[model samples]
Target chain A: MEKGILETLVGVLARPTSTIRSICQQRPIGWAIIVYLVASLVSTIVWIETGFYDLEGMGLPDVGMPTIIVGSIIFNIVILVVFTALSHLAASLLGGKGGYGGLFSSFGFASLPGIFVAPLAVVGMLPMVGALLSGLGNFGVLIWSLALYILAVRENYLVSTGRAILILLLPTVVLLVLSGLLVGLLLLSV
Target chain B: MSRSKIIALIIGVVIVVSLIVLFFGQEIVPPHPRVAIITLTGPIQGSDGGLPFPDTAITPELVRGLLEQAEGDRSIKAVVLRIDSPGGMIAASQEIGDMIKEFEKPIVVSMGDQVTSGGYYISAHADMIIAQAGTITGSIGVIFTHLNVDGLLEKLGIEMETVTGGEHKDMFVTPLTPERRYLIQRITDAAHDQFIHTVAEGRDLPISEVRELATGELFIGRQALELGLVDRLGGRQVAINVAAELAGIQEWVVIELAPPVPSLFDLFLGGGSILREMAIARLLGDEITLLRTLLKTYSLPRY
Candidate 1:
């Protein structure tokens, strides 16, 4: 019998090495991408609806319905595609054997943790400990997803754990520094 | 079951729970019988939020939005309009009054310190009116006032220039020309007739009796009741009880409709609005000056 999608997801979370190996071998990139995209969209709509972004220091307002839908789709697609592409590039540079398609499948499946993390981010928007909880929860999800992604990368490329981590962190660190610079410029101009 | 099968079930539960939360995020609570209270305490004008600053008054758009909300909510059995104002723009008053008249739910007007002129105009069409004994109401006519300042300009050695497409366009200039006075009276009389008819039909009183009371005379709540301008002399609680009885609801939650909270940007914008209000207050100097300015700003000419 074929494993159900839920079974595959549970496998991806609990047994990342074997799950990434199977996912890469099967190469079901389309289904994996759709799952990631849909989860991202739903979580985005929840974040907007719950007024989660109405916290201090963000300088963003409570976005409306149309903005939520359009912005979520654009932000999710761009971020997901860009991050997947960057991982593929990093793996290629590191002399890994996997193609862009396999890396995409591995990373998309790796985003399964977001489904659980999104609600926690929402809960963090509550009154007293809201900002701290939201930050901690999101940070926890990031660390968890990073761990899963490292395993997926390692399995997909037949690379060592150290190599997989290097592949993942290179693009992420560059993007963070670039975005920080951009934000700093904007603040100075303002 | 196997370990993978158990994990699959757990993941299924998580997915279902998350989906449920996302879909029903906005309206988590169920509905119940409610009476919406919309308080109008200042000059009624256009919709809220075209201005940079905050407004404490009822706008035409605000009242209509609240009415629409009450209408759509299955839990809302009735509406209570808590009104306290000397008067405001005729167009705004009529707009709000028309909405109140068209509403299917029972509405009771609770008059506070003062609900006269355009304020009365809006509330007259309600199912019932309740006023406090000390309330000043029943100013049923319209007035148009303007600043002449012709003598002041002349004394200051400033010659006033005028340009107009129509001969009557400059009627707002001081020295109170006879033609301008006649025009003003004609406009006020037409508006007065409309007011009288609305009050007469709404209160089920005769046209003649309404015309007698529509002489721009402000009356105390007790006097107004004696003259049939008001239904009862009581406060907000009595109005709420009467509204509940009319809507066939014994007990209901009260929903007060206020304007939405302003954005963070509004805190900065509020400064400009305060300066504008201060300028107007300075020009006002006293009650009569304030009244004159209000009439100039908000009075709508029927012509």
Candidate 2:
């Protein structure tokens, strides 16, 4: 039977290990995408409305509302796909067995914690300690998301916690090295 | 209940508690007395998106909108007009000045380093004008410049042909004709007359007296105070105090109003990519300032 979205969301935070295991097995890519997109949409709207991104002093150009919304969604989708691809590759390299559907669903569900923090973005607009609360709330959301990501890795591939962490760190390490090399090359050419 | 369910229930409870503490907590807070500060930085130009460059300068529409917001808000006891500009076009200055004059709430003008020409024109009608001791202000006059770049084109060995609907259509080309110059002078004089007349009425000085002092001369805050052009010589805090006194309020909270909702261009092209980083900065107030400094230090200069 398909799990209730709320029940699954609650499960993800409460019992992440089993929640991710069931999500991988069920391969509910559609539901995962919906949850991720809805959460992202709410957070992005709050981000714009609250003037968190409205620092004119930074001289960043503001695009249209539609563009921001559409561009952000497109970017989120792209990031999701890219992260899935990287994770799949890492899993295969590490000799862990997991299908693309399972990996995608598990990763998608991993983003649920981001939704809980969406309201915090709006709440953080309050005066006084609003900014600090917002920071802490965002930090909490990130930690939750990271934990979910690790659980997704471990359960989907049946890997140990240490191996799951290694798999998760692979993409970031690769990106940093590649960027550093590109920068070094440009500097050398100059 | 199983361990998983128990853990789930605990997590749910924590999330609920956080929501109450962080979200609803703001609503439970009491409102305080606030003095809204509307900043008018850069030149007071006409409008946006007309020229090759973007119109990042303060415009009449922006000023008018801010004045209306300040006027409508009861929480806002008084408004502070923080102006730092060398001035802009004539029509924009007049529109903004009229709006400020029409504002029912008490307003105090806080002049920055450069408040001259149109800047002075707008603030002259405010309830109180405060400037720093060394602030440049009171560039009381009007001017119109017509570029005669025909010689430069000739030096570059470039000849331009033109078609015109009327005789004076090509009048603005290099080497301004005598009739065109006379017409331009008349236009400048008319604008000058309007400026002095408004100043005289606003300052309660005679038209002749204003005209005598309005010779396109720049003055420091001390000189402006002596000449009765500006009411006081001080900075932003003093302006706030005066505004509080004028509004008959003993205690007040000073809050700088956010600039008008950023243009869409700002949303997408400008600050969009840095949304994540900016969110982090917004959460950590001081980090935003630090991030801005870091961005400025490393980012390539724009022309």
* Candidate of highest DockQ: 1
lDDT of 2 by residue, A36-108 (tens): 8866776666666554545343345657677888988999989999988898899889988988888888888
After TM-score superposition, the amount by which residue B47's alpha carbon in candidate 1 deviates from its true location, in angstroms, is 5.7
Against the native complex, each candidate's DockQ, computed on alpha carbons, is 0.13, 0.12
RMSD of 1: 9.6
**TM-score of each model's B chain?**
0.80, 0.74
Listed for each candidate, the true contacts retained, as a fraction, are 0.22, 0.04
> On residues B78-135, what C-alpha lDDT tens digit does candidate 1 reach at each position?
9899998777777778888899899999999999999988888888899999998899
Interface CA RMSD of each prediction in angstroms: 9.1, 10.1
DockQ of 1: 0.13
**How would you class the docking of model 2?**
incorrect
